[model samples]
Target: MNTIEKQKLSVLIITLNEELYIKSLLKDLDFADEIIVIDSYSNDKTTAIVESFKNVKLIQNTFEDFTTQRNFALEKASNNWILFIDADEKLSPELKSEIINTINNPNPASAYLVYRTFMFKNTKLRFSGWQTDKIFRLFDKLKCKYTTEKLVHEKLEIKGEIAVLKNKLIHYSYTNFDDYKAKMKRYGMLKAREKFKKGHQPSFIMMLLHPIYTFLYQFIIRLGFLDHTNGIIICYLNAYSVFIRYKELKKITSSRI
Candidate 1:
């Protein structure tokens, strides 16, 4: 269906140096009433590619934590209903249809959780703790905003009821191994800062054990091994991120003394 036939909904996204996937993802939003891209002042072709889509509004802001950027988008949205999506995410036809119908419901939910089929750089992993990945992507902007505890993950604070959609969003996968590693490292740094702000300190034992537990939990309990090689890599990366988080926290605290 064309955009005009769909309900008035603003699709929001926060991006940073996502030139590779921006074009294709934008193309898929043809059914959205309005598309708004909030960029973190990328030094790449991200903004240029976004401008190519005249219908989509491109706004650049200095890089900040995830919650801040997302809340900023809420204020910029003209429509009461908004769908927050990532640059690396795509909506299947079925999922798009479900969203349209849900919004048009006589008494629909205030927010909705959309599950994802996460791809690890072109390869889809069935297990590895990714199978249950879900996000609150659709919501009423008037009733929801991201909580302030943001650095690693941004969570929505909803005032009303939330529901889940059956169809899944396609996570377009990461850039590459090295790129993903850098991404994880960045997240770890942010996480450490956030924890420090909360008056939390990392112990030597916690730092040492957290990563080990992370690896074991995902790889064993979550069945990352079932996914074979890629799953193992993902589990390792997750574990490393935990270790880095603690390591950064320790550094931040020690410097204060």
Candidate 2:
């Protein structure tokens, strides 16, 4: 652990067949006192590559729900403050510097929410719903951990204030249109199940109207138009995702009842 004015810091990342981006992140965050990688038994060279890094601590767990997986990763962390990174995401140089400075200056706040800039292909996506996608990825371990229930997009429950960082965590969420669609199918299904179990019912009117509203909201109101063709594609796909979720929820409900 590097000596600093503040408490020790831990970094945690979740992965499954993510051999591509994991190494770069570990290299960049070499200052982390502990780097815990909770992998879902990746069959690829992910484990082999990760083992090559002296600083990384790799643990294999069976594929489980995302909430459980994240909570498990949280348990493996060994420091007071944790910086959560996804296997596919990388901490920008500016963000890396900011993280060090923030911890050294340890605020009373329980956590810090960082901004994310998603890149598709070689282009940096500046519009659509992803523009303002901020997440609470840095936190004091004692003060917070992930919620144990929500599966797909789990969030932490914290009681203290949250500080914001200016630098962004670069998210390589989409490699191409095909990747985006495939992810949408998986995520939409998960979201639908959650919503269904929570007793959220969307009427026929809502199904018809909401998707359109969402498209306009993201592309027009959110100014996704500024991004050109990518913006339009994003809005359409996101709206389509909503429709798929609703449709899948209906299927789940019908089968159960």
Candidate 3:
């Protein structure tokens, strides 16, 4: 069944230095009526590769913030509904089926949340915090907006009810431990900056307890242990990032005080 004939939708992606993953992602998403790729001046072959695709509409936009980039991409798309996907992720076969089904029959829900299956190295870390991670990827273009202030972990602002899509978005997040740590460091800085700007204060208890709780929640209770060593590392690094964020926030707040 040609889902495009029933519901018009655009597959929008905002990318920066994503040459390795873009082609694979685009290959499976041929069902999209339009493909809008907003690139942030990648010195890599991203633009060249995107041009190779017949349907892709590429735009070079400087990366400022996630909200600005995504909103800018939305403006470029002609479709009324949009499916936002990351360059590092691809729609699983099951997810492709779900998307086709959803497009064939528009659900009453305004937005749809899809789970992501995150892979670390050679293993699929199902027990870690990533396993149950769900994000709102499909929504009406006019009804959603990414938060401008909170740049990282930016979520769409939707007014109506959200529905869940059964299949998962395959996320090949970390190539190695170093890659994971590097990302955490970058994300921690952004998160800390956001907290400092908000005038939020972290107590001693929070600074010490939050990371401990996070590690336990993800590794033990969340069954992150099932993934064995990799799971433990993922959970540990994730909690460590939290600790670093609060530590940075505390220092920033203290200096201001």
For lDDT, candidate 1 versus 2, the one ahead is 1
* lDDT tens readout by residue for model 1, 1-257: 64433358999999999998989999999889889999998999999999999999999888778888888898899998899988899889999888889988878788999999988888888998998999899998888888888765788888989999999999966668887888888899989999999999879999999899999999999999999988888999989999899999999999987
**Candidate 2 clashes between residue pairs 3 or more apart in a chain or in different chains:** none
Candidate 2 residue lDDT tens string, 1-257: 86646667899888888877777777888778899989999988899888999879999998666778888888888888899888778887778888878877834578999899988766898988788999989888788877755768887888777889889988988777877887787777887878887887756776778789989999998988998998998888888888888888878888887
Which structure among the candidates has the greatest TM-score? Answer: 1
Compared with the true structure, what per-residue lDDT tens digits does model 3 show for residues 78-99? 9877899998887777787777
TM-score of 3: 0.86
Give the lowest summed-lDDT range of ten residues in model 3: 100-109
Greater TM-score among 2 and 3 belongs to: 2
Off by over 4 Å in 2: 1-6, 202-204
Question: Native-vs-model 2 lDDT?
Answer: 0.83
Alpha-carbon RMSD to native, per candidate: 3.0, 2.8, 3.2
Write out the backbone clash pairs for model 3: none
Clashes of each: 0, 0, 0
Predicted structure 2: clash tally: 0
lDDT of 2 at 7: 66
